[model samples]
Target: MRLSKLFKNAPTVNITGLCLDSRKVKKGDMYFCLPGMTFDGHDFIPQAIEKGAIAIVHSKDIIDKLPGVIYIQVEDVTACMNQCARLFYSKPSDKMTMYGITGTNGKSSCANIIKYIRDLKEPCGYIGTIAIEYGKVRIAPDLTTPDTLFLQRKLSDMVRAGMKSCALEVSSHGLSQHRVDGIRFDVAIFTNLTYDHLDFHGTIENYFEAKSILFKELVKEDGVSILNIDDDRYEDLKECSKARVVSYGIDQNCDYRAINIHENAKSTSFDLVYKGQKYPVKTSLVARYNVYNLLACIAALHETGMSLPVILQSCTKIPQIDGRMEQIECGQPFHVVVDFAHTPDGMEQMLRYGRQVAADKGRVITVFGSAGKRDIAKRKVFGELADKYADLIILTEDDPRDENPKDIANQIKEGIQNKPNLFVEDRYEAIRQAIDNASKGDVVLILGKGDEPFMYHESGRVPWTGDNICALECLKASGYGENNNS
Candidate 1:
């Protein structure tokens, strides 16, 4: 690609690549000096040039002239880099049908469901919290929604690999920072709005407003906007969107409605009502929230030219999403579920369903904690919800980045009233204690950090196994391995 095509009134230069970090700059690469939350790329301009960056795109004015490097000043480096990335990638999102799912929860499950159904008919790509996968190429994710440059590059790769569709999990921080600015989505889904990320967003309304940006701008005019009518902000989202609206829920009048729902410990069955007809839908995924997720997937696929029968048939084949409500078994009499429920609403749903799964059999034991340096107000709320649902609670550490784990756990302990709770700072000890105390017919829920590979602390991320793996190890140590019938 030529530099003139990406920049305005610029000399012709062959642009080899685009880079944001100065350390990653290579020979003939164009480096972008953008300002971030903590570090300023402008301070590293000399390092970028030293690392063989041929062209420098910066926001600050430079009076000193380098020997052979080209310096292009811009009003905003972030916006300029975004445009340059789109040009370099040839706007690959335009060639494929893009589906974006955004909300406080269920984004990963819905995105994976869409990918699963689409992959049954044609090649598809997925970008979310779990992983980025397309055509046997799978990579760990750095963010729920990546930076604009990497996002465009990955979409271009998907296009080159002959993927017909793609599903993305759009986070509020990603939207507010314009990480997905250049891509136009064919379908936008709203799961629900709840209390989360208040430390960054300041309030719930600001968070919702940030999320509304996807429907208002990124979605094409003729695209479809699928929303959950059961959410309180459904009407607001409908009014904010310029695209055609397609609502899905169990309550209000929606384009897709799930009725006669039947949920068990293993599976859930519901009749999907569309227009004036009802279609039987059965899925291996449990819980009520997943019914909403399945409906959202069905609506998005239906709008994208998939038949109702095919969508229903695909629902039956949709496997369990990792770390959402994943069950781990080891020939034990009790049940163990590992989930990524961190927010207040998510905790409530997980506990409610956990209680249902353990009905008349045993007690519900919840093991969870709040993340450090996040919305501190939600800590007490999480404690309150755990007290309301679980028979026993164990508060453990969940990424106490810079704050003390004891302080974070104390805040959660303040909300519990006359409930049996234990404070354990070590996460491994907490999991072991929960499992060891559990009797036959008891359900143990290990929450917060689900499939994550590491534990964050002041010293930086340390190598750690996932919750499922740790629980299985504990069960094995207790003589509950596959061969043991006790």
Candidate 2:
């Protein structure tokens, strides 16, 4: 790993140390001058060189008159740094099984589930929305998929730690940006694609193209393509994939399908129909979406040579994923469910289950909001869905990053007009309003934030827990306790 040998592929010089943060710069390290949306890295080149940086990798446009510094000017520094990172790590992903799960929703859940099961036998690494985890070491993630260099280093570190497998969440933004260009996937799981990130991709087609890159081009020939046939994009992906395809859904024609889907407030039990054979699988996790997620996980385990009985036995004790259809009952007469269903389709599904759980005398009241600066096109759709399903819609602020919270609320309000609801921009107040509107036989669904701990706004991120904290307060507000419901 000598500096000279590392930069042998470069036209001019080789870089030794890798760095993004100048404060962490080491002697002989290479500093990547990335031009972020907020701050330009070119401004830090002098500071980086002053801190004993041997060379600097930057775009040609930023070429300056730093005579002493070894400048490795490239057409694109971001792309080059990623390439160098892979080289520095000795391509460790080659030795390990890497599973790439992509889609609008359930990617994090499915990846975490697989990681949990895999870790039961051996050390399993994970990189996703939750965080990047390897054994006891955990770090909050800045992106769903880290930059290529960070990714390679993490993979190398996991391999050195005797980790057998890694479950990685591949975001469409990362895939389309060539951030994961060189890595080969051992398995690619598609949860389902829906309208999201339209502000970035411009259209759903472009978004799908970005996600398809992992399966269409990134996955290895011997890799397994775990697909949700229930997704509308499955047929197209199947026709284009070179890897071995395995399909799962509730549809009988699928390779793996769920049968007898019995879902209630406490849990869901179902018979999994795979290849004409039936396998019973029961889980404390409720909701029809979870049934699909379980099917995806089961399909992956099946491909790994795990017997149906073994898979069922191992996955039986799976705990409720925090903030994802997470249930909190403090002896209430009815139920309160929390979900990260921000999208229109997800909201509809959540409401469908909420109404089912609130059958007969019960009613369904929903509290949710659209995120700012992200897929604004879906705001009206989300509002329309909430209006159509919930007995009472409480529109509140979710994440109003860089966008006015009132403005975002007004957009959603426009669509939900003429409907019976409350417009409380304060998320906690919105939740309280929903709870106050609910009666003894009523269910309340708090959506959008899920397990997230922070409430993001244009001003700053504030401490908030829409689900867990709200549940306790709502219960107290509703006069429910251990002795109340009975």
Best by TM-score: 1
Put down candidate 2 lDDT per residue, 1-486, tens digits, no spaces: 555555655434545668876777777788888877688787888788888887787785654557767677788877777777777888878887788889888987888888877777677899987788998888877788987778888899999988888999999989987878767788888889888888889889999999888888745667888999989999988887779899999864799998888988888899988778888888877888888888898888678665678777766778767678888777777678888888877888899988888868888898888888888878888778777777888878888888877777778777775568767888888887777677777889999988677888777887776566787687787788877844
Cα lDDT of model 2 overall?
0.81
Candidate 2 Cα RMSD after full superposition onto the native fold (Å): 2.6
| TM per prediction | 0.98, 0.91
> What Cα-based lDDT does every candidate model obtain?
0.91, 0.81
lDDT of 2 at 132: 89
lDDT per residue (tens digit) for residues 153-177 in model 1: 9999999999999999999999999
Worst 10 residues of 1 by lDDT: 215-224
Residue 286 CA displacement from its true place in model 1, Å: 0.6
